[model samples]
Target: MAAEISSDLLARFAAIVGAKYAISDINDQQPYLKEWRDRYHGRTPLVLLPGSVEEVSAILKLADETGTSIVPQGGNTGLVGGQVPHATGNELLVSLKRLDKVRAADPDSNTLDVEAGVTLQRVQEAADGVGRFFPLSLPSEGSCTIGGNIGTNAGGTGVIAYGNTRDLILGLEVVLPGGRIWHGMRHLRKDNTGYDLRNLFIGAEGTLGIVTAAVVKIFPKPRSVGTAFIGVDSPADALNLLHEARANGGGTVTAFELMPRLGIDFVVRHVSDARDPIAEKYPWYVLLEVSTQSEEGVGDALEGMLMAAYEKGYAGDAVIASSLEQAADFWRLREQLSETQKFEGGSIKHDVSVPIRLVPAFLDKAIAAVEAFIPGCRPLPFGHLGDGNIHFNVSQPVGGDKKEFLAKWEATNEVVHAIVAEFHGSISAEHGIGQAKRALLPGVKDPVEMEMMRAIKATLDPKGIMNPGKVL
Candidate 1:
């Protein structure tokens, strides 16, 4: 809504954060303009790196006064183009990487306060250094930032036991629209005052406010661990094994992952260090883990459950890791599945979730639906079976044209999402509805829910400056 950015506006932005931190050159902004998946390439005129909250306030004040749009970015590792600017090339990009710092860590209270720019892996290392555990582990933890994770409400492998990024957060410090900072960073577990603003911004995908820092809950590190790689007869068998393991371990099953046999084959064929934990081939495989505070019988519990499942004909074969290195080797097969898919030509991806009891039915119906829609299409469905979140991806037919297959992205998406809708499942489970899923929101969300969200967004960001064209 504002006019083209003038020299005065650029100079003021530079004055707030020193000139060295403000960049306007077109060539220098390429790194910040693109996203991780290369799905969205936005265009912007300037990139600003503010070192402190005060500088961020100053920049927002100026931007609001001039009606210039602002796009906040962190690590540039988002998959849904939530942190990138729009294609208009008019908004300014604000990077929070300079605000990387641990404000405080209270081990007694089991809380750690950190700035938004801190890398997730760094926060995990800090928690480990203090003999505590932060259980938000993701594939992009090495390069992703806490702000981006909170913005997306990221759900990683540990979500089966712990929770999503929103559940781990105790409080947040956000800079609101028009340069007002909300100091709501409390470590208390119960705060039922009025409206919970923190929850609104947690999964808003940066469309409400700019999150500066947060106070996150931590837990005592596990003392004993167990990991197992099992070959299952089918998805139904895998779900049955999950219930059996949870029952046998006294609800201590920390992680349970399901993958198609083809995913394991792809990983073994592509990744050098990733070899199949189980030599036998089945239609489906499961990688499970259980941890306990006491170091008495972690491995025994896993083996006993597997044996019971084998006796019942649910499990075909199993391999329990004997050492820490062996456990890691077992997990390598699951974690490397996504990266190995790159060797395949073109892959259409979907992150959907259903009730744990209905996961088998949903997968069966969706896979059959996609195959019927396009014959010979390869479907690789894998993810956290315990939580019912599956990464249902489809590869092009063997020796098919990559571009031609990719051109049917919408058709393929419809075939899969129709089955999801029929089963009352969500189209996006872990990855949020950023720019990628904005247009499809109305089709999935109820009218009443969409109205409530729109009301909240209008109340918080009336001018529509905070991350336009995303989420809502």
Candidate 2:
């Protein structure tokens, strides 16, 4: 049974978090309820924007005592319905947007102590100000919060080198259900302690608890950088170029992306400031980059790698950015690949990851499958090629009905995921399974793993009031 969030209960919430922050007005709560894809429209009787960890603890404590489910939300930029509430309006929404504060920046330790609501961009800027880099680069960095990133274990373009949010996290401070605060925010790199409680909440999607704050890893700012967009005949050829790039530059290979001709066309047509870096259109392309913390030879190394790939026939042609502005322009094409497709109509998207070597074959098989499923469908596969994570998206064909094309989302997902499973790839690569992939979880995840996850959830959140309908 759903706990009734009565007027008296709302009053109590207001008392705990303050009246102005406990927003009950439907108009004021729209942003908290809606999300990026416009798929999940949920209802919440009250939206609580707690400003402090103490306030969040108080809210969680009260909800646990009252048996009210809490949907802990960050910036609400999550693709899955993890950040959104259920349609029943039975759950209470808790927004951590007001918790936007960088508590400390320890340059010696190479770590930044930041609150959950701190936007990813702000954290980056703060790191830059201190002559350091927090390299969690993504399209949604401007709006996505680090807390939300932690919740989903987000992996952006930097995953080729720095790694996912989980890897970048040094420590965490979480607010468990029933209001107990777990202050495991140690900045130490070596902690051979018992079970890692910090990791439990890192990718839990709020089903476990609310991440109040985090201690994130930081690095010395790179001094030199190089960017290139290569024209390739096939995904196989792209992988070849990847090997060359890695052999020459190794760890300097920061972001390596596989973009299809269709994706490039979409970016050129839809995005105003962006243009095709490689003038001639090839069947496929790879937007790649290399960088070094030492300024002397990074650019020359990148140029030599690109030249070698071209000579080997792995690359048809390439464009090496002469200046930082041009490099940004090259990356602009990769960054807007996903958003530009919105102009094309409904898209059936998949965020899957396979073995580095199997990526080419995976793409070939998946592309053929989707095209066969729906003739005239445009298979736009593009993403972090270095990490083997591809955002393989299918755009509705010309003169196709938008609703009808979107209706095939589930079927298309199954088609692609079945092939993904054959190669031992992850179905939910970066996007955490909220409502969108909740049903698909049991089929994809191991039975033993599922049981273990259930046991943990049951143990920690015995009342099952923490984001009631999300994750497991």
Candidate 3:
């Protein structure tokens, strides 16, 4: 239960962050209200931009006392509606962008302390500045913040080499519901203490608390790199190529992406200067990258692997990047796959993951099911094939009504998701279960596991003032 947000109550929240920091105007709050996908839009009475942990603490303390609902937002680039407030305009939106700061950087220990508001690109740049590498790369790295990454345990292209945000995080600084600061930002990697409390909030989706800062691990930068774009007959060949890549690189393969010809066509048609890496357009393509600490045999390894793959009929035409610029161009095509799909029309996207061996089967069945259900919908599937996550997106047919096509979103999801479940895959892989998939969680998750999650939420936030109606 939460209290009604009156003008005076809003004024009280504004006093903590000062008038300049408080955003009461509806127009100013619009940007924070909607998600990037434009699928979930919400309204809030006030949006607070707090500059310090103490300010965050004070806001939460007062919120707890007043029984006010608090929705924590970072970067506002989240696909899920977890960052957005309810349409009732009663919850308070606390934006962490002002808390941007690199508190510490130690290349010697290969770790850095960053506030929640620091963008992922800035973190990568900071790591590079310190002669290290932070491998949590994302397409929205320019705007997505550390807090949001931690909230969702975000997975990106580098997830195959480096794990998700949970694996990179050493510890997190969180503000509990009653404004109590949990100073758990320890940099030590081998602290086998009592309970592993650091992970409790990593993928909690802000239902338990607000993450204000984190100590994350950095890695040694690779001295040599090899990137390639290969044409494959189908997802099965792509999977076989992935097997050859791993066997050839032997722990050096960083990314193996699967992109359909339709996705590449969308990118080429919509994105300027986006050209196919291979002149011959195959049904499926793979963007493969491998890196090593030494510069000796990366190129030779990639060349030999492709040669073997060609002999086995796993790959058709291939182009290994000879220059860094060419490698970037190859990546640009893969990264722009989702962004350019909008030009095709309304897209129903699914971030699902299956076991690596079952990727081809899952895609085959899911694609067939969606096409049969929607008749003329374009199935554009692509993502990190090395790690088993696929961005299975379906674009509406030519001259189709966008609204009408989108209206079948739920029904279409049922068609695709049913196959995913048959394969023991996850419905929401990288993206957290925000409002979009909140209702679907119970059907997919174990009953006991769901109950345990609810008990933890109630234990941490008894009043349920933290991001209500979000992930249970």
Candidate 4:
């Protein structure tokens, strides 16, 4: 039962956080009400910026008692509408930006206890300050918070070597639905618990609970980093090159990204200081990376592997970065691929994953299916080839109207997702199924798993006050 907000209840909330922090003016809370992509615009009765964990608990207690829904948000850089509130204008939006803190950093243990509100880039710098590495590299790291990363279990270019955010997390400090704080922040390497409750909140998309703080694992800074650009005939050759590099490099391979010639052209035209590393253009391109803890001859090893690949006809043309500056520039081209698409036209995108071995087939079949639907539609599929996850995006045909192109979003999604299903792949790979994909969940999710998710939601949040209308 949804209860109407009374003047008395609003006053109580205002008193908990002081008048300044409890924002009610539309202009004051506009940034919090709108998502980063502007896809989902929400209205809230009040936006509460809690400064501490205890304050968060108190706000939740009041909401639970009054039957008011609470939506927890961090940097609000999410793609799936996970951080935005509903359009009802009745829910309370809880912003956690004030809780940013670095509680501890232990170089000996290679671990850091950081608050949820800390930005991902700040976390990386803190690790680098201590001469350690925090390899959760993403394009949005400058704005995305650690809590949002853990909530969505974010995966970026580094996942090929370091895995996703879930793999780097050792433990968490979460605030449960009913206003109780669960402090399970331990630095233990091995703990055989009955059930790993910490993982339950991870990738839950803030449905299970709000992660307040966490203790995350860190790695030693690689002494040597090498990057290379290779042109391939097809996705099959990209896969073969990946296998060869890993076998020869012996686990030092960190990234293997796939991009089409069209995507590279977009970057070169739109992005500043972007140029092709090689003179000749192939149908497909791959930016591969290798990192090693030892200072000895890592670049030599990478060049040697690429030479073998070229001799065996796996690579058409190639360029290995001769210096760290060149390596960074090479990666910048791959990282900005998605950003460059906006200038071309509206894009219908899918972040999906399949078995590593089946990726080549998935790409071929998906491209064929999409072209059949909309002729001349530029299929810009790229990202994390080593992990079998690709940001499969379709840019509108040349000289097409942006609005008209986006009007067929649903049709494009169906065609692409159908191919994903055929390969036994996930519809939402690294990004969670937020409000954007809520309607499509039942069609793809197993009935038994859906029921279990609902059951857990009911048990933990019977009143449905935590992030309502999301991921259900």
**Considering every candidate listed, which one attains the maximal lDDT?**
3
Clashing pairs in 3: none
TM-score for all predictions? 0.98, 0.98, 0.98, 0.98
Give the CA lDDT, 0 to 100, for residue 377 in model 1. Answer: 81
For candidate 1, lDDT tens digit of each residue in 1-472?
Answer: 5557888878888889998899888789889999866789988777999999999888888888877788998888887788888888778899999989999999999999999999999899889989999999988889889988888899989998999999999999999889999998999998889988899989888888899999998899999888889999899999999889988953378899999998988998998878777777899998988989986788777788888899999998889889999998888888888888878888888989988899999998988988887788889999999888999999888888889988888888888888888888899998888888899999999999999999998988888888888998
How well is each residue in 1-472 modelled by candidate 4, as lDDT tens digits? 3556787898898888889899999998998988766789998889998888888888888888888888899889899998998887888888888889988999899999999999999999999989899999889999899999999999999899899999999999988887899999999989997889888889888887788999998889988887899999989899999989998853388899999999899999998899899899999999998888888787778778888888888888888888888888888889889888899988888999999889999999998888888888889999889999989999999998889888888999999898899899999989888898999999999999999989989998888889988999
Score candidate 1 by TM-score against the native.
0.98
TM-score for candidate 2: 0.98
Off by over 4 Å in 2: none
Model 3 per-residue lDDT tens digits across residues 1-472 = 4556888988999999999999988898889999878888888889999999999999999999999999999998888799999888789999999999999999988999999999999999999998999999999999999999999999999998898899999989999999999999999979987999989999888999999999999999999999999999999999889889889853388998999999888889998898888888899999999989986788988899999999999899999999999999999999999998888889999999999899999988888888899889899999999899999999999899999999999999888888999999999889999898999999999999999999999999999999999987
**Model 1: lDDT to the true structure:** 0.88
Q: Name the runs in model 4 displaced over 4 angstroms.
A: 1-3
Number of backbone-clashing residue pairs for each candidate, in the order shown = 0, 0, 0, 0
* lDDT against the true structure, each candidate: 0.88, 0.90, 0.92, 0.89
